[model samples]
Target chain A: MPRHELLTGNEAVAHAVAMAKADVIGIYPITPQTTIIEEICNLAANKTFSPKIVHVESEHSAMATIIGAAFTGVRTFTATSSQGLALMHELLHWAAGGRLPIVLANVNRAMAPGWSIWTDQNDSLSQRDTGWMQFYCESAQEVLDTIFLAYRVSEQVLIPSMVVLDAFVLSHTSEPVEIPDNETINKFLPNFTPSFKLDIDNPCSFGALLRPQFYQEVRHKLNDAMSEALIKINESDKLWKQLTGREWGIVTEYRADDADYLFVTSATTASTAKPVIDKLRKEGLKIGLIKIRVFRPFPFEQVKKYLTKCKRAIIFDRNISYGHHGIFAQEIKSALYGVKNSPEILCYTGGLGGKDITPQLIEETIIKGTKTKLNGSLFEWI
Target chain B: MPIKSYEVRFHGRGGQGVVIVSKIIGYAAFLNKSYIQCFPEFGVERRGAPVKAFLRISNQQIFIRSSIEKPDCIVVLDPMLLSQHDTLAGASSDCLLIINSRTADLQIQKSFNNICVVNASDIAVQNGLGTATTPIVNTAIAGAFAQATEIIQMKHLEKAILKYSPAKIQENVKAAYQAYNTVSKPIPLK
Candidate 1:
């Protein structure tokens, strides 16, 4: 039986990781993201969780250690934020190219040049082409549930996955999460064993220098796996939903049917935009919200199919693409290209450095999207 | 049925545990059948620097993830913070103001809203909960909020504070009672 536990998003992820029985857990403490590793450390110290908890000197070492462990073909987990994730840039690609199904929970924070510990998407969005599967969660429950889902999909496809959520918005905020029993999780996700491993009996060279021809084939294989993982994502979501009676698909609809205006958002902003959508709808406007939960595989086809109903669309992004438009807005435009009757897309960026994205701001964004003159500017920062 | 949502903001300095105060209030509200969210606001966390923590409670889950700009109530944990006089800048028109000072009545000018006061620092010190120099008034104010605004019950605040306090649970509980007993009736300024 499931029980409702009031937990922060960090605690929920830690709980999920514990239930998943990750073979290795490596972490370094970073603000907002620290409490998560702290919870995991406490669990390990108390013997509730048995994974080797490594308190590495730095975030880079944390990722490096996980890479070596994941290459052995065991379930592995790590958590980081902002500069910590940035420090793992080299290994992020390595984990993907090495075909290691490593699951990372990245609490997204604004990158430092100005040195801020606030929530933002730039940290993860900046790594858009890292070839890792990405899932942006909106609530604590979703944050917890995505861990199992990310691991399942990653392990099945042999691709790394990043479960991203806003720093304080979801990370520190507490909410009631239905925690599924360990037996149920074990049944859903059995102990992970890699299809191929670094075993002495079946010794094989890994991550060696490759010519362009061989490298292209390796890259192609990664793409094929990522494409296949989309189906696995849907499969995992369905399986979890069937077992736990809770489900979050790649794209969650918010009263979007029979509506022509849509708010395309991810993470906490999607939830904030929802009530505004409802309020507008109550006032006889047909505005709707479409939460893109899974960002890695892009869900381009689904985005196109669902977006066909929109007369206008607003892509609310927390990340600013310097000298250009909001990152998600840019991605949506790319996704909607050549599709007939695609909505008129507008991008609005705010909530940088942990600024609040109130329902009022969301409503204003909707109104702006509906009435903008569209003088060819990429986006306007609110 | 519609869910009513209320926002509470805390103004204080660092090291006073205002952040945890917000969390305790949130936990209490959650246990009381209200969906709760709380977070701290500051550019850099330094001791003696002004810091703010916010809380929101609704019968349904709150979707807005932002700082409480227009709070229904504002609780000031440090009486010294009143000297700058920018405490209740964005409070709602019909706000409830709770302060942690014996002389708060003299400080607040006449306003249409209600003003309630309790010497929370004295309560904390009287109950031997905080040090003499850095008196901790957060837990006391959590109790004061319950008494002054009736947004939360006494039992719920006690349940949350004692459960979450690192040490001196008994002392904190006593301080809570001290504030609960001492908070003045809301001065309704006509």
Candidate 2:
């Protein structure tokens, strides 16, 4: 039986990482995300776990160190937040291009212009093109479950993965978590016996300079692998449900059957939107909610499958893309383009830098979605 | 329908172990086999500045992640923060206010009929739990909260404090016990 414990999302991730028996963890402390690595360090010191804790000075070095460990066929882990993640931009491409299967926990914080360390998706959303498989978690249990799911998918596909959660909302928040014991986790995730590695017995060039012809082919193979990863996520999710008693796939649907208008959200906002939807429904409104669980490999099929019936869809993006629009809303619009009688996508970008997206604001946004729900690139400051 | 979840908020300065108060309550609830969730007021917390933390304890699972708009009980670790911030706003008329002070403010006692006052800082100081100038009142406040609202027991609070404390375990336990004994019973609303 899975034991129930009160754990912060950070602590949950740490517990999962420890259960996975990662070989190396090179972490640099930053707000919100700092506690994840700190908890891991404490667990390593107090428990029987013995992952090599690489004390790195900067996030760049942390990413770089993980790259070295992963290259040598070790399951590696690392964590960071906004500016810390931003500092590792160049190395992010390296891990992806090399297909390291490294897992990172990104506590999503607002990017620094006015210098705020609050909840927002801008940090991770900005790296959507970085080729790492991304999974957005709604709660502490989800954070714990998704780490193994991410590792399972990433290892099979041989690509890096990121598990993103809101800054203070999930990262700092404590919740009831169903902690699966190590023996159960071990059965699900075996040791990282790499198929290919850096060894004297098998010498081969790694990350060498290549021409466009070979590079294009490698990129195509990576693209094909992403489609396979979607299949892997579905399979692993089922197996996880069998092992534990809970599972969330690429996306989860709630009350969309009789809804005229639907609200789309991710991370903690999706959790908040649920109560609002229930309240509005009690008041005799036909509204529903769809939470995006997996963002990378985009999950367009799941999004379209759940949302095709609605008259309008409201995509809530906590981070702005500056001149372009909301990051998530832009993706939702693109996903719905070229479809016949598609639901309108109302783009609302609020809660940046940890601004509260109250249940009242969500109810109001549903009303606003009814008005602007008629499509196009709308950059609502809300 | 009966109450599904109980919302509790804590108001204190940054360095007063305000955030830990939520963890202690949640841990106790978890030990008692009830579902509990907690979080602090999202901010770049600085010492001596006002900070707030929230906790939700329920018999069933709690799924809401939003800020508690109307808290069922409010614990004021730094009683001065009651006026510095609207800690009492949006609370029910009969909502409980647990203050860490030598005596309950008459106005607050009148405004909130269900109120309890415990000299948490003095208890902490007497037990040498904090510096002479800055008395860390988190454990003491937890004890006061236990008596005023019965959310967590004093024994559980003391155990949690000691479990997390690297040094001065007895002192913290003493501070909490003192507050638990000294805190006035909550005065029910008329």
Best by DockQ: 2
Per-residue lDDT over B53-170 for candidate 2, one digit per residue giving the tens place of the 0 to 100 score: 9998988767678888888888888767666537787887777888887665434523666878788888888888787668988888887777877767766777677666657888
Reference contact recovery of candidate 2: 0.74
* Candidate 2 structure lDDT: 0.85
Total clashing pairs in model 2 = 0
Clashes of each: 0, 0
Interface RMSD of each: 2.4, 2.6
Q: DockQ for all models, in order?
A: 0.55, 0.60
Q: Kindly give the stretch of ten consecutive residues in candidate 1 chain A with the minimal lDDT sum.
A: A370-379
Q: Over all chains combined, what TM-score does candidate 1 have?
A: 0.95
TM-score on alpha carbons, each prediction: 0.95, 0.95
lDDT of 1 by residue, B5-93 (tens): 69888899999998889988888887788888787773567999999888888988787777787888888888777665567777655
- Candidate 2 docking: what grade? medium
lDDT of 1 at B184: 68
